[model samples]
Target: MSGHHGLYRPGSSVLHRLPAQVKLVAALLAVLAVVAAPRHQIWVFGCFAAVVGVLVATAGIPPRLMARRLLIEVPFLGFALLLPFVAQGERTEVLGLPLSIEGLWSAWELIATATVGLSLSVLLASTTSLPEILNGLQRLRLPALLVQIMSFMVRYTDVVAGELRRMRIARESRGFEARDIRQWPIVARGAGTLFVRCFERGERVHLAMLARGYEGRMPMGDASGAPWSAWATGLSLPVLFGLLALTARA
Candidate 1:
């Protein structure tokens, strides 16, 4: 199945060739390493960023596309930017402004960790299709229920969105504009109605799946797991970074 609404860009890069499971696990490890690194070790984050930059370049995704994808970080950036002013700690003056030292460290940590985590996730999505991500989670022995929920969520979110769009178009076509607060109930009721319709559709879909022998699991896909060389190749960066993190603590 094609990716429903994923960021996957087709390519034959080394990342695209690696098994989804390997890439997923390696990305997780990379994010964890970045998160666990000492906040004072700013250089480690730079190293992690460099590694991600290399992957982005190798994947053939344009930098503008990556920068746009990273826009999701804006909300986190706002919160991080607020931390230094609001948090309490030993204060230091920066350009005649008082800032809490601990808060500054916290802000740095938040931005660095969140940026790394989000970038790694974007890398995964850019390289692997949505279905493959679900498959990888299943291979990792993630709870079957959680996996199913995610699978359905990924599959049906578009349906829900389309339903919403249709509803909006219908409403607008009929001159159902909310000109004031008095019309708010109409919008709320429409939203609730949409939910009920979606719920009923989900029930129908579930019954259909059960009719076709869906015995509480999705059919397995290509089981040819990553080769040992792929593991060594895919994990090399994370492992090297892990060692660097360890050495930095020494």
Candidate 2:
């Protein structure tokens, strides 16, 4: 419920106003359409990116925040870049380096698809609160156990992170600087201590919840209602993407 919790940006944009379930489905559909699209038709991926870009703009997401979140894709981008060098196929020269022709095409497709997919996910998370997302999944008939697990993970991740941070500060205060490999054992022990503390904290939390009348599942309050207009507005982009993908396949 904190103002800065997770990736939920405070805004009144139409994207922010849409029901969480609607946004979830819209994102899923858009990702599926991106995956379904033929790899050779690179223009289709461009169109997909354009659509997601417009939505991100409409959502009023800050470029800095988006850029920071997009850092998650750096590893995937690196792998894609390497494809041109390692993949076996017809060879071509670029900047005096011989590369596979097929690898170039494959890399392009990988980068494009990854960008679109990750963007859609980032957009969804940026607009929807973690609690709202969990509620939305419950409404969407996602498995009860799976939803519950996700809910707990989201709730405790911050606590675990705080514990780790405090441990780091304590180490720094004691003048224990991890400057080299010799200090790595100390770092590993710190990590092990953090794990034990997190485990104890989780046990205490579970016991408290049990004593407070928590059953196997957390009580989700009333589901947010989605009107027809909301559904239509939310799904418009995905429908367009789907049609384009189908057209490209045809």
Candidate 3:
């Protein structure tokens, strides 16, 4: 909710210097490649992981930081762990316990897919500033409405979170105890109040935008200074993915 990690840290690394649009496109291609990979192909998953590893290394991001950041997606990863119990599949026995063979395979597939997708997404977010990434999306021909919504959402998320924090602190100052399950109504009311406050804030922000001549589109600076080496590095992802795909198919 803090949205603290959405901004790119200024660095001399090749990734930081790359044009945002190029990086975005390359990230999309990498995601597609990972998605297109066959479920049972362990080698293909390894290849995807290797490509991500190289990118992480090249970008000079710490492995521990990447792992911690990416771990935010683990709730969805839990679905992978659960699939082996609920998924329809051939029956098998392991350690005197019965399980579905197909379910186990499905679980593995889900984990691999989620790991690759989430890792790539986290890398993108970590390396690119939110504004730059949004601008890149606009350049890539995303609809204006979608762009505006994303922009506003990103801009106000921190504000909303700060408001929630202040509200909680104010409540706690008066000896509000959240020790009972039945006291959840207080939390619910607080959340509802926050929603109303966000709405009012949005209205004020809209009026301010109108005063500033914002006609539903935010102006963005041109990204025209990417070096050739950055593009070269970005292009390598697709080539690596293609090679991996071929290897998996073979």
Candidate 3 overall lDDT versus native: 0.79
Q: What is the C-alpha RMSD of each candidate to the true structure, in Å?
A: 2.1, 2.0, 3.0
Q: What is the C-alpha lDDT profile of model 3 across 1-250, one tens digit per residue?
A: 2335553555557777676777887888877877777878887898788878988898888898888887777788788777777878687888976778888988888788788888877777777877777777877788879988987898877778899999999999999989989989999999999989988998998899899998867776574555678678787887788678777877
List runs of model 3 lying over 4 Å from the truth. 1-8, 223-232
TM-scores of the candidates are: 0.90, 0.90, 0.85
- TM-score, candidate 3, is 0.85
| Model 2 per-residue lDDT tens digits across residues 1-250 | 3425667787888988888999999989888889889999978887888877788899999778888998999988999999999999899989999999999999998888888899889888888877778788888999989988887777778878888899999999999998999999999999899888978987998899999998887787678678999999989978999999999998
**Candidate 1 steric clashes:** 0
Task: For model 1, give the 10-residue run with minimal summed lDDT.
Answer: 217-226
Residue 233 error for model 3, in Å?
Answer: 3.9
Predictions in order: lDDT = 0.85, 0.87, 0.79
Superposed by TM-score, candidate 1 places the C-alpha of residue 202 at a distance from the truth, in angstroms, of: 1.9
Worst 10-residue lDDT window for candidate 2 reads: 1-10
Q: What is the lDDT, from 0 to 100, of the residue 114 in candidate 2?
A: 83
What is candidate 1's local distance difference test score? 0.85
Report the number of clashing residue pairs per model.
0, 0, 0
How do the residues 20-48 of candidate 1 rate in per-residue lDDT, one tens digit apiece?
Answer: 88998898887777777888888888888
Q: Residue 235, candidate 1: how far off, in angstroms?
A: 1.8
**Candidate 1: residue 162 Cα off by (Å):** 1.1
